[model samples]
Target: MSHDSPLQDLDLAAGFLEPPPRRDTYAGWQRWRAGRGHFAPAPRLTLGQWRALSPRERSLYDLHRTATHVNLPLQETPMSLKVSRLVNRRIRNNALKTRPSTRAGVMVTGWGYQGKTETVCEVAAAFEDAWLAMHHHLHPQPTPGTRDVHAPVAYAQTPVTAKPKSTCQAILGFFGAETKRLTLPELIRQLAASLDDHGTKALILDDITRLRMHRADDQDTLDLIRAFMSMNVTLILVGVDILGSGLLRQGHFDEHTRQWVLPPSQHARVHGLEATQTERRFDLVELDRFRYTTPGQITAFHDHLAGLEANLRLLKAPPGMLTGGRMPEYLMRRTDGVVGLLERLIEDGCQEAMDSGKETLDEDLLDDVVLSLDDPERDALAGEVPAIPGSSRTRTTAAPRPACARGRGRNTVFDDHGPRGQAHG
Candidate 1:
């Protein structure tokens, strides 16, 4: 019988198609090879050779070698989940003791850029998690008249173009009730029935500022708030200082409502842990700008950055490319203690290095990167080099030269260069 084809041979002697490049020289070759498979000695290429690649070729090479795309899970463990739970717990506790005629209310106010939105997000997460826990049988049966009305509600449960009803009817629908056209009193009765069924007692309204800002005098909105309060429901109203200002100045709510201002003392207490401590006792909350790097955290972050720069210098980076242990200092100076600016600086520097094919960044690169990072208004002001337009140049050509410089052709006389130029004008 004929032997099996060599391509399909079984237990046949192996033969090499080509020898691999030596390991020591592979790295240099790999850099030059750009995108064609692993580097091979037969197809040696220089840095110039790689540089000469067409844009498309280079892109393909990058894709084949260094480029990778990942569809990161869009869903992250929501950062606000914990804070939401705490707020929800307070709400539920108040709701349990509240009656249809009496309720406890709290107003939360802070300046803009403070973590008001984040706080609201956290509260929402807590509510969601609480519902999930109960559904999964991890929590005991919810107490009657204290259950969350919104937990069981689905977005698709309502029909399109349905007329708005009483707040109690809305709440009932939230609890998966199909009854429609509920009167105000009937709605309240249903709400009580549902809460009793689910054992939920608390309610939270994030950003009462919306109502205050848009429709402070809208009877329906006012009635809704009043109704909840009358039911003795523990209500937490989150808002910016504007909301508090609005309430105090404009009188949105009646005098019976209590206002608990979050002073600096509360802020300090919440964020006042040692730098190295884990599991912060108080939620470290602030306006968005002040969140990532607190004033207290800045020094430590700078210290770490300095150490990193020093280590890089110790590794003997090229002159001009070397940070000279000044990168951190430069960043600190440029940022002026703004954490957001510092983050953008780092991002811009890294991106510039990648674009320029430079293994190390220089001071000039940092300056350019920082300048590029400036906001439009800042950039406009920062540009000292005047732009000479073509039309301006044409106009200058049409205009007669200064009398003193007429014989000197187009040479500028008042150059401000020295005494000779200065004296001529």
Candidate 2:
């Protein structure tokens, strides 16, 4: 009780001492933190290395086609690499800054099953691993950067309903809280505390388009999201190509910008904006189909096919015969350069090969599968739109990707809901 005691001059470390959220216990903290143990570093055979791997050895016994099909998305894509690099740079910059500017947010949008989730998961894992690496650094002596490192990367799916309370609850769910029964005030308080407890730097919100809104909850969710950003939480929203209202100032949906509109025509640009407008729209990373439009593109396309064929179970032609054939060209044409569609076609073809006891995806089997897999919705979207005079807004559906990767389109009944028409069935 001395005058000017040491306690008088000490600022308590709230992040270090804060108790767990009301609904979350120390057990939950350990459970969630246990996830850190499972991650492995970047693979030795990176996707590029996979593409580069090609040998002339001829044998169906060595290939693992089924495994390849299952693990296609698990293997890193260029898009995934780009996303990881972006997340790492964002976290590293923010962590090291003395007076950081607004955290950079990113919106990764694509059609469903077009690898959005996988890409986001990769980014989240990569972010989490950085801290893991920092924590497990070898030297026994106290180190500068590694000592204070704490892993705070959280991945949570946005709720189906775009309410602020729901969104808050979702963020809390990732940290292992029981969110459903908690009151909104309790949710927010616990959420902030958890963020502090983990020293969270980034939160990857998957299926973020679900956060889109049209009701009063719109403002609520928007405010909540804004509050997270204000807390120095870098938010990455992953979802469908179109992000709905609440994020936009105007609240209108625009096809070209691929962002919600803001008020009085003041808008946010997801990509290509100046540094000053960083807060308005996220850094846009759009994933779309892989087209074989250029010579280099075609070679890369062939390389991709070659990699897949390398793993195919049955060998009908010479090893890597698919690469030499005009099949890749035909594939690009049929698939319209949609990677998901292409993969689906390959997957179905592989299944047919296995089912028919032929172990080989011959041209006829691929042909039958392609005919059966053609989509109706894509046809409808592709058909002509009557041009309106004086409206310069030409809606350009991605040459189907961009997450501009727009399809692995569903098998709807053919036109007129007719008996599966073979013509682009």
Candidate 3:
């Protein structure tokens, strides 16, 4: 299943109770008392009531506003769920490996600010979160050399000039192993041992692009990764396309090499054992980019905007949120629809409004905040890599994507009072 699958399996919302849904009066703001609830004016309060709040109250309210609004792009749940599924299957297979297997590790690559790191981290965190949620005893000792350790997923970054040895050392350090005294070969062996010892299902290696340049050639580095995975620990590599680095270019050596515990995945191109240089050895799944508009509710920036609106207990919310009607189009132009960029721009705008004593986060403040941000020359999704063919294990044919309704090529006039509209304005 794609990201459209329900997140009930994640079970992430346990223990930390949720507050009851606040009233959505849709027309007012109220007194900004800094108690547990009234940090921001109520949404139903009149405009005059909001303006009457003291500047100190507004500043406090803005702080609360920023706190709830700013977040990583976890709301784009498709990639997160897909990655979790792949990693979960790998972890389970490794834990239950009855015989030798050569299951290749997962490699996730994306450009900067594509939410690759954050999304993978969230996936990694889920293992530990799930572990913590299910365990009755806080101090339960984990079995070493298995995939059921206290921390099932480990994450780290490759050094700027990381060779195989350095990469091993960094990973070893994450395992809480002493790295200063080990030899290079010893480091690699220890890292493998630690993965089994700590029950780590997968090791997430990020910023590994520099490893290619760290050496005059990347052959040894590729061999190092190959050797590590041969030990049966799944490695989820994250970074840019190494292009011809051979890190993700070569398939399995022979039929014997493919006998490891994993089953073949016909839908994913990465499951092949041996491939030509022209063939991709690793599957490429680009992060879901936010669209200016979408026809359906499955994964869109509109959902993200709706989430932000739900959390603002004490901050002033505008009539139309960041997703309302024309807002996504305008916001996409200002921030290019990157989650991090969008959040920063919104936070800055909220701060500016509170500082300027503006009552609500409106189009005026947003326009001002984006003035300092670089302007978009084209559509936010421009230059995105095309979806790879036969690379999705659970991808299904669906309805064609909807046309964005806010931009050019569509025109209409909305009468002051009704839902009916006139086209070709």
Candidate 4:
């Protein structure tokens, strides 16, 4: 192996250094689960060393840097750690129950850019990895004479234009099942059958808040989701502002605990007899952005910045480039302490630093990098964090947004105006 190339063994042209799997399909999920986490960062070189390298090596190093910067490993924050533990434990408990009744599901609710989906998916994928290994790559209890993929975790996204039939089709599609001519009932039946046939125990429905209660179809989809609990799959519903979405309108919110308490379904009224509320429970958890009010929170934020700064590949980068002095406070203002926005700002700053030949991040260099001001979370927090030097708070744009995009939601479950529900830090 030559010592010149940054990535000694892997060839970028041969696709050995390709990006990660899509994670939306079965094959992609399997590939993602099996893939390693590390990506070799481009070797940092002094100006003299850089000048000595041949043009080929320089190009390869640049290519490698591009890949490494964007594909930086997922940062585990306090919110992610908490959610992961809760989700993994619940899924494990649900998978063990042999009962015919509904297994308790979990609903993860938070603001946009809070990384709900990524946290849940990481835990679910890890569960599947351990499950397959334990089962010797076979379905633990296979259906008689039938050959089906043992997908312990079935992941699906709620369609933007959601309905009962469309939602069912999405889940069914995850298992590579056919739904061309199937009716709504047929689709649900097939979905249930597929879950059993494929030995799926956890079904994650991301962007679940898209099922608004105002629409008749969406309401029907909500009911269908409740009905799915009886099918022996632990449901993981991930969405933004789920409490405000009216998905839990059927339940009452308790002020004391700040949680929604569901009263049993009133089935007896339709049956012309007295009945108790359904005992189905969904453990609702929240993942919020970092706050700087408390001393502990401030320490955590500094620690997170330290982690990001440690991974930066800038050759001229000084220690405490992001963590020292007023940088953390400036970043808090720019990003509203949202992990996704913070990561974007840093990544863009890194790119700018490399391109501008600065090779170091500072307040002035990051000023040129603009993040989406349309972010609802950032917009909401703008008033609280006072403007600082080189912060987006101080910078103003004269150009107005177009008419079509004006008054449009920047963060909502029904549309993809910005980044999808993915974790950045």
Candidate 5:
């Protein structure tokens, strides 16, 4: 059999010809021949390694690995200098004082959206550890009376019918003695007792208005107030402006309560002046809407903005800069001098920007956030105006015309005196 030329051969062979190598295989062969290093996939990180990463590094890793990078939200939001300093001073003073008294507490009151709740929560968290420490130090042991009651009874050197025992049992615990499960009143009493036992000199009740409102009975609230007052515990009662008005109306509180109404200026003065021989105390530091700012304040705000920007950059954000230099001006106008408003605006603005995948915050975004705020004053204004269309016109008009007289050619209306003569009066 004469085989066809190799180029023209066409055999119907059942066995398949050797398959050509894949492109990757050839590339691998070439790489191997060239003695070039092979590209190995990056090593995977274990959970422990991931956990050990710093926040900044983690943020960068997330950005590099994913198209959508979610920022790690801030835990402790920034607060107004005024609010911060006031809270700090109050907490420090109360913590350091020798006895608990009503005057030692802090009272914060402002309109809604002014960060009243946030302020309270922040203050609580800031001092909670210290409060726990103080609580422990004060109630180290049960009272002698309670201990004596626990002694076993004896009858003629022998147990006789197990001497009918009293039903009441004194409960002892780490905190103190409790006759029964503690209610609010019992808890307050126990806390007071513990403080008294430990020489705690200060007490802080954030939104005392809530307590007042919940305990509507004037006498009951008054009694509680008196208990705090009698203890001479420096008390701080924080609430909205309505709190001041409510306290004024309450029969229990009078000029004495007003004495604790620390003005913003006093707050500023105290913050400005360190403890001097004559002053020797922390004054109320008022955060001024207009004045009372230092270069440090601006620096602090800018630093915070810079940190935020750095986080944004890790997400591969296009070069963006925060122009918060005008933040003070923007805050002043938007908040209308309310410290709480300023803080909320800043916090909300950041959240809004992050939500929208924005790397930079502009004035428009801030204005939108602030202007959308609910205005309580608007509600009050609506209440003052009547709904009738012509009511305002009627109110603007002078007293209705008295009996009018018809003149020869013109109709005339009367003044307060009576009907007035027309053309020939």
Candidate 6:
């Protein structure tokens, strides 16, 4: 008789937790908030202990470890902490306004893969958690709403081909409102009603840079966003390179406060909708990448590395595997201090280590793993490297990459030598 398939014999789903849900809708946002930061790290095992496990048990443990690695908690950095404090303060201040006035909103602009979306989402989720607990899990100001969805924090993405009506529908979609055959006026009314009924204190519109002002539809969509301020919700717009995206048309930076300020428009209303809250004011913030310059900067980067090293589940991982002498510098060079890229590199490196039986991360092993910057053409396009601050040295010997390891280039314009004050528009 044929034995059962090994894959079928092992229960892959036995110990896995429900995966984290997207935060784009009411249901998803609630599920995400409840499950945020709930993942436990994979158990570390000694080589002897690993060897003691049965074949099926080892396979299950390996799969569980992979899941834990993929779902590693986002490390708290200086930039992320500052963003959270500022965003939470704004939300708290907006919620306490007894007077009828439009709350000042915030716009977060940064380069791609700098954790802008994750940082803002974390802040919003934390705020919602506190707000709900304060109200004893009841809507503080409940309207006669049909659905029982008490969404205090609404998160929606800007549509790819966004128009005024479609933008309204996007927010309404978060509340599970039916948008089919709905007119623009009906859509706005529904959105406004939902926002009021659900007691939403903050509305996060991600990928706000998707709107191009050159198009009439996009310009109208911007006006609609301005009008949304009067609905008594603090708007948090997160995007990449939003300052240069023409979203803040005619905004000037104040040298004293260092904020890009947008004055009220003097134009007539669009769609005959009176956008009384015409002052398009937003405090532009950026979640910057890591820098390797000063003593404080070096300490911060080392602390970050130490945190990651502690979370790793490799059986043979040494105490300072990630934070040791050359590993940190090598990682900095490979990722250019970007958090997302660094995480991806470490994740891939860990997978390689486990598969190759090395069970540890190092320079030689990481050298074989190519990143988006590995392509020679992409490296050339990345322009001249800026010398590291407080040092005047250059890389001499380069580790040879694998033969078939040509990287896929995306953000090749940012040089990897040092931190840049501004992203290329």
Off by over 4 Å in 5: 1-104, 113-191, 194-202, 210-219, 242-244, 248-258, 261-320, 324-358, 363-425
Encode model 3's per-residue lDDT on 1-425: one tens digit a residue: 12432221222322113432211110110011111232222233344544555665444434444454443224545445675676556555564565556545666654444567666665555555555556652324465444433545666676655666677776765655688877765676677667766655567777555454334434455556555555555677776543333344344433543321222222122322223212212334455445544465223566777765555432355655665766665565554555556666666766676567664566556655532324342111211222211101212443467988875663323101111111110
Q: Which model, 1 or 4, shows the larger lDDT?
A: 4
lDDT tens digits, residues 171-288, model 2? 7766666777787667777776676566677777766555434456755666566455544567777766433222444344458755443322111122111234333335666665
- Shift in Å, residue 135, candidate 3: 6.8
Q: Over the stretch 167-248, how does candidate 4's per-residue lDDT look in tens digits?
A: 8888887777899988876787788789888998999988887675777888777767766766788989988767666778
lDDT of 1 by residue, 1-425 (tens): 12332112211211112343221122322222222232211122244644565665444433322221111111112223343554555555554453333444455444432344435534433454555566683224555455343332111111111222433444454455756755644555565556555444444444334333233343334334434443334555544443332333323333342332221112112223112211111112223222224555444545444433332211113543323456544554544323334444544554565467663555556666623333431112111111211122243455666667446465433111111101000
Error of 2 at 330 (Å): 2.6
Give model 4's clash tally: 3
Per-residue error for 46 in candidate 2, Å, reads: 26
Stretches > 4 Å off in candidate 6: 1-17, 145-148, 254-259, 263-268, 271-277, 372-425
- Candidate 2 residue-wise lDDT at 419: 16
**Candidate 6 versus the native: TM-score?**
0.82
Error of 2 at 65 (Å): 5.7
How do all models score by TM-score?
0.37, 0.60, 0.61, 0.84, 0.40, 0.82
Best-fitting candidate, scored by TM-score:
4
- In model 2, state the lDDT of residue 144: 51
Error of 2 at 220 (Å): 2.6
> Which of the numbered candidates is closest to the native, going by highest lDDT?
6
Per-residue error for 57 in candidate 1, Å, reads 17
Q: Among all windows of ten consecutive residues in candidate 3, which has the lowest summed lDDT?
A: 25-34
Q: Give each prediction's root-mean-square deviation over alpha carbons.
A: 20.1, 17.1, 16.3, 5.9, 25.5, 7.2
Backbone clashes for every candidate come to 23, 18, 11, 3, 31, 0
